[model samples]
Target: MKYYSTNGQVAPVSLEEAVVKGLAGDKGLFMPEKIATLSKSTIDGLKDKSFREIACTVARAFFGEDIEPDTLDALVKDTLSFETPVVPVRKNCYSLELFHGPTLAFKDVGGRFMARLLGYFIKKQGLNDVNVLVATSGDTGSAVANGFLGVPGIRVFVLYPKGKVSPIQECQFTTLGQNITALEVDGTFDDCQALVKNAFMDETLNNHMALTSANSINVARFLPQSFYYFNAYAQLDRMGKAGEMVVCVPSGNFGNITAGLFAARMGLPIKRFVAANNRNDVFLEYLNTGKYTPRPSVSTIANAMDVGDPSNFARILDLFKANEDVHKAICSKISAYRYTDEQIAQTMQTVYSETGYILDPHGACGYQGLIDSKLTATETGVFLETAHPAKFKETVDKILSSDIEIPAKLQAFMKGTKQSVELDKDFVGFKAFLLRQ
Candidate 1:
C-alpha cells in the first residue's frame, strides 16, 4: 500500500517508507491510500482466531507483499505476548483491560508493533542511523522507550513534561538505558510535541539525520490499536453477550478512537464510541460543535489526555472528509466528552464502591464519560483501561485504601537500567539535544 499527504503536495510512499518517515514531507500524517473493509464472514470468523492470528490477518491485508507472512507472524507473536481481556466491572460497563502488555499500557500495542515494523523495514532496505523522536504525557515515553530499546541501527529520544508525569511513569522511561533516552522538559506535553514536530519539519535536521515518530500520530503507531476493538467484540460474542456497544476511549492525540473509527469502517458492529478527555477537552468541543479550535493544554490527574491541540485530529478529519458516506460512517458512531480531576476521583470512588474495581485516573475519566452519556444497559459500555492502576498507586491506594499489585511485566521493568537528561522545555534545548545525537 502507498500513502500520500493530506495536503496533496507530497510524493506517495510505500508502506515501509510511510512507517519510517512517520510524517509526509508536506507535514501530514501518512494515511493509508485505501482502507480495506472486512466482509461479514470475516467479522464472524474473527471470533475463532487467536489475537495473534487476527492481528496477522489485519496487518497482512495492509502490508501485503511488503512484509513476509512468517515475518509478520513472528512480529505479532512477539508483540502480543499477553492477552487484552475485557473484564466486567458492572451490569453493562466493562473494562477493556489494555495493560496486559509488557508496558502495562495501551501504547504497548502500537509502540511494539511500530518498533518491529520499523525494524523490519530498516533491515529489509538496509537503512541505518534512524532517530525516533517522541512526545509523552505519561505512558507513551516509557512504552516507546521500552519498545524500541536495543533495536539495532535506531535511536529513540523521548521528550516528556518534567513534573507532570507520575514518578513510576517517569522512571519507566528514564531507566531503560540502551538506545533509549528520555528528556525531562520543563513544559507541558504540547511543548514536547511541538519540539518533536519542529525537529521533523526542520530542513537542516532532516538533512543531517533521519527522523521518525513513535507518537500515535504515526500511522504505524495507530493501526495496531484497531486490534483490541475487534478483540473486545469477539470476546463478547463468544460469551453470547454481544450487544450494541459504546466504547469510552481516553483521548489525548485522538489516535485511539481514530483506530476504532477505522475498525467500524471495516464493519465491526459498534454502536458508538466516546472520546473521553481530561482538562484538554479540545476534541470534546469539536464533537459538540463542527468547529475545531485548539487551546493551551491544562494539567489534570488523567495526565495522558492532557493534549490541547491533538496532532491526530488531522488524521481524524482526513478520514471523514472523503465523502458523505465516509463521514456518516465515522461520525455517526462517535461522540466526545471531557472530565475534571474531581469528577475522575469521584467516579473512581463510585466504581470501587459499586464494582470493587479500582480504576486509574485515566480509566475513571472514561467511565465518567459513559455515565454522563447515560448509555443504556442493552448498549454495553466498555471503558478503555489504558494503564495499570498501580501506575497511579498513590491515588488508587488513597481511594481504595488498598494496594494494587504491580504486574510481572512492570516488575521486570523495575529491575532494568535507565538513562535520561534534564532539560528546559525550550526549542533551543531540544535542538541542542538533537545536534548532539
Candidate 2:
C-alpha cells in the first residue's frame, strides 16, 4: 500500500509515487510501510494452485490495496508468463530453475512486472515519456531491456560494465534496438550503479527527464521478486518436502535474497536462507565480522553476483532495525558463503558429472553454498539457479569441455548487432548524455 523511505527523512508515499520515483529524495530505498502476513489456510491453499494463481495471490497481498484487483491480476498474469520449475539436482537438494523466462534469468519476473506496473502508472498520469535507469552486472540488463521493450511511454537505459558481462548477457541487451539503449560504462558494476543513482539525484536531469531506476532500488522492481519464492514453497509443499526447507539464493545486489526475507516475514515457512556469493564477499564478511565494508567488485566467473556495494542492504537494515539486531536476526535465519572462480568452476564440473545438471557460474555458487553449509537430512535445500547455463556458453563449455546448446531464445538475441553507447564512469559525462537525449 503505502511506502516509506528506509532513510526515514522523507514522508511516506503511495505505491504509484514509489514506482515512479525510484529512489527517495533523501537517497533511500523505499520499503512497504507494513508487511501483511498470510493466513495458514491461505499458505496451505497455494499447494494446489498454478504458478500464476499463487503469484496473483501473493501479489494481491502486497499490491491489492493500492492497485485495482483486476489490474493487479492482469499484471501478475502477464509478468509470470513463464514457469520457474523446481528440479532435482542432488539428494535432498533441488534447483529452482528461475531461468525459464524470455531473458532466462530470475530478474525476468521483477523486470516484466515493473515494466507493466510502471507503464500503467505512466499512462494513468498521462505522462509523455518516462526514462528507466538500470545498472546490471549481467542478467538484469537483458531482463529490463526486453521487459520494457516497446512499452508505449517508457525508454530503458541499461548501464553495465564494459567487458565484464558475459558475451551472451551483453548481446541480450545491447542488440535490442527499440526504446532500449545500453550504456557500456568503462568501470565496474558499482560505477554504473553510481551513475544511475547520481542521475536520479541530479536536479537538472530529473527536471529534464522523468528518470526512475529499474534496478532493485525501485520497490516495483524488487517486490515482485517475492513471487518466485512463494511459488518455490508451493512446489515444495506439493512434494511434501516443505517441512524443513532452506532456500539458497545467488545474491548480487542482495535484491533476490532480500525478497526471500520479505516472504519469510509474510509467513513462507522457510527454515533459513543461504546467501551465496562469488569473490565479492562483502555481505559474507559482514556476517562473519558484523561489519559492513564495501569495496570495488572483483571480476569472477559468476559475474552477475559481482556487486561490492549492494543497495538493498539498506532494506535489510530497515527490516531488522538497529545494526546489532539486524546482524543477530540475519545470522539467525540466514547463513552466507563465498566462493572463488576456481571453486565455482569445480562445482559446475562436479555437479554436471554427478547429476547431469549443467550449472551456470552464478548457480554453481548457490550449489556450492548448499554443499559447504551441509544441510541436515531433515532439511531439503532449494538453491535458486538464477540464470540459464547457455548464457555463459564459453565459460560452461570450457569447464565441461562440451558445447552447450543455446536455446532458440538466446540464439535469436545473438543474431542482432550490438548497439551500445560507450561512456566513462564519470557521472558528469553520463548526465550530459542524458540531458542531450
Candidate 3:
C-alpha cells in the first residue's frame, strides 16, 4: 500500500519508503493512502485465533502488499512472543496488561515490529547502517532500545529527559551496550523530541548519515499498536462482553490511541474510546474547548503522558480531515478525561486495596479515566495497563507504603551499568554529536 504525508507537499510513496524515511521530506508524518475495513466474518474469525494469529491478520491488512505473507507472519509472531491478557479488575472494568514483553511496556509491540520491518528493508536494499532516533518520556526508550538491540544493520539512539524517567526505565535502555545508545538531554521530553525532529530535517545531518525516527511519528512504529486493540476485542469477544465495549488508552504522544482510531475505522466494533491524560493535558483542553493549544509539558507521576505537543496529533487531524468534523467524531466516540498526580496515586492505591491489582502510574491514569467517565451498567470498560508497576517502584512503593517486588526481568536490567551521554537539548549540539558518530 502507498502512504502519503500529512503535509501534502510530498507525493505518495510506497510503504517501504514511508517506513524507511520515517518523516516525509516535507516534515510530515506518513499515513496510509487508504484504510481498508475488515469484513464482519474476518472480525468474528479473530475470536478463536491466538494473539499471534489475530495480530498477523491485522498486519496483513496493512502490510501484506509490502511484505511477503510468510515474512510478515514471522515478524508478527516474533514481535508478539508474549500475550496481552485482559485481566479482570472490577465488575465490568478490565485491564489489558501490556507489560509482559521484554521492556514491560505497551510500546514493545510497536518497537519490535518496526525493528523487524526496518531490518527487512535494510537487507532488501543492501543498505549500510541506519540510525534510529527516538525521543522518550519513559517506557519508549527502554522498549525501542531492547527491541532493536543486536539487530543487524541498525543502531538505536534513545533520547530522554534527564532525571525524569524512572530508574528502572532508564536502566533498561542505558545498560544495553551493543547497537543501543542513550542520550540524556538536559530538558523535558518535548526538547528531546524537538532535537530528533530537527536532526531529521537538517540537510547536513541527513546527508552525513541515515537518520530516521522510531518514535510514534514513524508509520511502522505506530500502526502495529493497533494489534493490542484488536487482541483486546478478541479477548472480550470470547468472554461475551464485546458488546458496547469502551477502550480507554493513556494518552501520551497519542500514537497508541491513533492506532486504535484506525482500528475503529477498520470496523473493530468498539463503541467508543477514552483518552486518559495527566497534568500535560493538551488533548484534554482541545476536547473541552475545541481549540488546539500546545505549551510546555508539566512533570507528573505518569511521566510518559507528559507530552505538551504530541507529534501524532497531525495524523489525527488528517484522519478526520475537517476541524469541526474531527472534534465531533472524537467527542462522539471518545471521552476525554484528565487526572492530577494525587488522583493517579489515590487510584493506584485504591485499585490495589480493592482488587489487589498494582498499577503503574501510567495505568492509574487510564483506570481513573474510566471511573471519572462513569461507564454504564451495560457498557464494559477496558483500560490499558501500559507498564509494569515495578518500573515506577519508588513512586508506587511510597504511594502504597509497601515495597513492590521487582520482576526478574527488571532486576536483570538493574545489574548492568548505565552508559548514556549527557547532551544539551539544542539542535546544533545534537547535530554535531551525530556528525561525530
**Backbone clash count for every predicted candidate, in the order shown:** 3, 0, 0
Best by lDDT: 2
Q: Which stretches of model 2 miss by more than 4 angstroms?
A: 322-324
Candidate 2 per-residue lDDT over residues 1-437, each given as its tens digit: 68999888999999999999999999999999899999999999998999999999999999989989999999899888889999998888999999999999999999999999999999899996899999999999999999999999889999999999999999999998999999999999999999999998899998899989999999988988998989998999999999998999999999999999999999999999999988899999999999999999999999999899999999988888945677888789889898998999999989999889999999999998988889999999999999999999999999999899999999999999999999999998999999999
| Candidates arranged by TM-score, highest first | 2, 3, 1
Off by over 4 Å in 3: 322-324
Q: How well does each candidate superpose onto the true structure, as a TM-score?
A: 0.96, 0.99, 0.98
For model 1, state the Cα shift of residue 248 in Å. Answer: 1.2
lDDT of each: 0.85, 0.93, 0.92
Please identify model 1 stretches exceeding 4 Å from their true place.
324-331, 415-418
lDDT string for model 1 (385-416, tens) is 99999887877888778888877767776675
Candidate 3 per-residue lDDT, tens place, 365-434, comes to 9998987788899999999999999999999999999899999999999999999999998888888899
Error of 2 at 47 (Å): 1.0
